[model samples]
Target: MTTPIHVMSEIGKLKTVLLKRPGKEVENLTPEIMERLLFDDIPHLSVIQKEHDAFAQALIDRGVEVLYLEKLSAEAIDAGNYKEKFVERILDESNLETKPVREGLKKYLLSFDTQEMVDVIMAGVRKKDVTIESNHLSDISEEEVYPFFMDPMPNLYFTRDPAAAMGDGLTINHMAFEARNRESLFMEVIMDHHPRFAGQDVSVWRDRNHTSRIEGGDELILNDKVLAIGISQRTSAKAIEDLAIELFDNNSNFEKVLAIKIPNVRAMMHLDTVFTMVDYDKFTIHPGIQKNNGEVDTYILEKGEKPGTVKITHRSDLQEILREALDVPKLTLIPCGGGDAIIAAREQWNDGSNTLAIAPGVVVTYDRNYVSNDLLRRHGIEVIEVASSELSRGRGGPRCMSMPLVREDLPAR
Candidate 1:
């Protein structure tokens, strides 16, 4: 079998996807850390896992290959040298100075399988007494030293935030928050050294100083010829430009890059929050934001023999522009929440617009986004709703639960 290359053309034809099943870290989310971790509330791990499994099954049922990130990361670690480098990087980045804690972390990293490793990394080392060196005039006894705390990575379940697939390779996104930086590092190691993806080129948003930060959710590959990047709260203009330069330098497939600026609102943290493609000529969109009256600005960067040029202007709806520019005949726009003003507003806030397309006319969504589901069904689309009581509390739905790695282009309808 040939090693799979990443080149997504349509959401429906996705052949491979990356997912992280919710774990103890998700359950441990407290109100205190919810906002810090970019969550609205805590969720029960069991329920969330069940829902995620259903979503995964939906994709599998459609013959899509689902690769759990935790599994891949674990297998990558078994490669020996790469594992050591990954561990050292984690230790150095986390700044844990306690000998016992460091030892515990090392042991944990070596002992767990892929699934368990994912859990421990997210749940984190328990708070316990740790030995540390001290240089104080009045020395406190080592026995009385307090336990050093290791904060659980509540946001790790949202794997879409750290790294993104760009063309045939990957881009390791530098995260804005320090609390989640370790997750990014973990993704970087996996994409760079994993056995399944050996010898693949990788891109980094940051330079040696590590100032750049971007997220996969904010990045969208419209086609081999175009990329739709969202400039949102999580992704900066500078980061987009940096990514553009990298793409220009390495990838020869893309001809244009569109920077769609979205409001920095908590609700609209990424472009996928407002728009996502479901089929070759169909899309689910939050018109309120992607339209002219909305808070986003659309710009196009066309590539030539040399590095491309950018053009900015007010324009028609994203769906309209994409349809006209790409010559897609009879593009369909499915509204979230059944197109009812009230329902659309409420459901969209609950991640109604965020559905992951398994294939043409098939998708996964939150059961709680009833209005959106109703709309999808009315459009003759199949809506597979996963339980959301626990999953919804985390402020993400089906789309956030999955990261598509490879998609086959659909023929024009």
Candidate 2:
């Protein structure tokens, strides 16, 4: 029997992947709440969906099985016959204003079939959409003009942040922000009841129930034996320590964790935003992330002398670390925009460093980053360009958008 979750390497041939198509939620973004919701700007709904469809097609064209999170969530609840239980969980995290409002939202959500129920929750529930029965006439304040009873999950399209697929297991992340925190709840529901993953041996190494925050974008599977998780603005150091301890003490193939630290600014909010694996010997990196001599603050985490503890070793040169970890003779770090001071900063903001590797020496990247795209091609790498006008507005490229479910294992060493 094939394991439901298997991601041994980041640059392995992708067999199956998960994506969330842009929906009405994109249209729900308003200037008033955009920043708080982690959006730099609002996107045009029609164009973004068209761009997203093309992106999905690009994956399908590569013979990869694509799964939609929205479809799976709907099917999971219906298959498990747990509609009421699912709705209750969503409302529980929604922070409804009052008992009357909570009951009203529950009834309205339950009225729809599973699919629409999922969509409505994602698109957000407008204040006027539900009717609440209150004993007093002044239950809802007239001066309270805030739009939504429930906030639209505009960031749902980036499925890579809520959960990460690792060696025969995955992590249901505790997201860093409240706006994106509830996004994991949807994945939790799907994992619990979805037919494809429910009965499988997939392990949840860490779940979203903790206050220590971690995100999938910070998690990278280097090979069968080593993993790279970043200490960035979105993922905390404590979370990485805890996850490393779990892998060290548990029955897992992962033997080491490289806790590399990056700038905490939003431009480099996640590690993948500025660095990603593009091939067995090639990686895309932003020059700005380096110190005086291309050195990054890196630490190696391994099983300690004592049980259930991790041993840490300090390292700086990223190239040396990669060579030792993969046992490669030489590794090339491809610079975004060819490491130009101005070009690197500009394209890095648009996620030029975030390329999704479908196969060794081949990657899918946003076409708008022509300079970076050209650089990858010149380095003897296969670069597949996708439409990016609307997609780049979300501040993520192909790597940030995708969550690989299965990948063909690389031949031993």
Candidate 3:
């Protein structure tokens, strides 16, 4: 039987993927709370939905099965007969101040059918929208001006962050920020009870229950034997170490973990923001991540002689390290914006380097990064460009918006 989650390589032929179509969650972002919600500006929901549909269709055209996270979450609850359990978990994590408010919110949310309830949670709940007949001073004196009973998850459309698939298992991540922390609950439910995934023997290498943070945006499966994780704003070095130890001790078919450290800044929040694998021996890199000497901090982790320990080696040459990891004699490092400083920064901000590889030499990218797209074509890669005016506002391209569920293994080069 084929595994429900089987992603061993970044450049494999994508068989199935998970995506969240832009919904009211994105529309709920007001200018005041947008930044706090990890969104730059409020996206036009209609336009963003159109663009996202195009993205799903693009994948469908390539023979990739596309699954919607919202639908899957609702289905999982129904399939497992856990609606009450799911709602309770949501309220528990919603940070409702008192038991009275929690119970009131729970009652309000439970009135809807499963799918509507799920969508309402994603869109967030405003205090004004739900009536509570509470005379308690705690509820009466609290700030009424505060917008929501639960904050909207604006980053839900970027399905790559909540969890990531690797080998035959997946990591339901403990996200770095409060804005994204609750997003993984949907993945946990889906993996545990969804009809397509339950009883499938899918492993959870790491769970979202930890305190240390690790995001899927920083996790990249370089090949069957190597993984490249980023130590960046969203992923802590400690999390990388923990994941490495788990994979090594468990025989997860991963032999090496390259912890690539990039500047911990907003624009380059995750490793995939600055780096990604495109083909067997080719990758797209944002020049901003490298020093003047073309150096970047890297730590190679391998199985140690002592059980549960890892052997660590430091390296600064990313190119050489990747070549050795993939076992290719030579490799190509395609710089975002063709290594042009200004264009690189501009395009990289729009996620020019975050290209999703569907097949060996083909990628899905944002059309706004024309220079980067043209350069990729010159490098002998087939580039499929998608509309990004509204989607780009969220600061994620095809790769950031996608989480591959199943991928056909690459033939030997």
lDDT of each: 0.70, 0.91, 0.93
Clashing pairs in 1: none
Off by over 4 Å in 1: 97-118, 129-148, 200-210, 290-296, 304-317, 339-341
lDDT of 3 by residue, 103-193 (tens): 7788899999999999999999887777666888776555566778898888998999999999999999999998999999999999989
At residue 261, give the lDDT of candidate 2: 95
Candidate order by lDDT, decreasing, is 3, 2, 1
TM-score of 3: 0.98
User: What overall lDDT, based on C-alpha atoms, would model 1 receive against the true structure?
Assistant: 0.70
Ranking by TM-score: 3, 2, 1
lDDT by residue (312-370, candidate 1, tens digit) is 45554666777765567777877777667788777878888887777777778888888
RMSD score of candidate 3 (Å)? 1.0
Name the candidate, 2 or 3, with the larger lDDT value: 3
Better of 1 and 2 by TM-score: 2
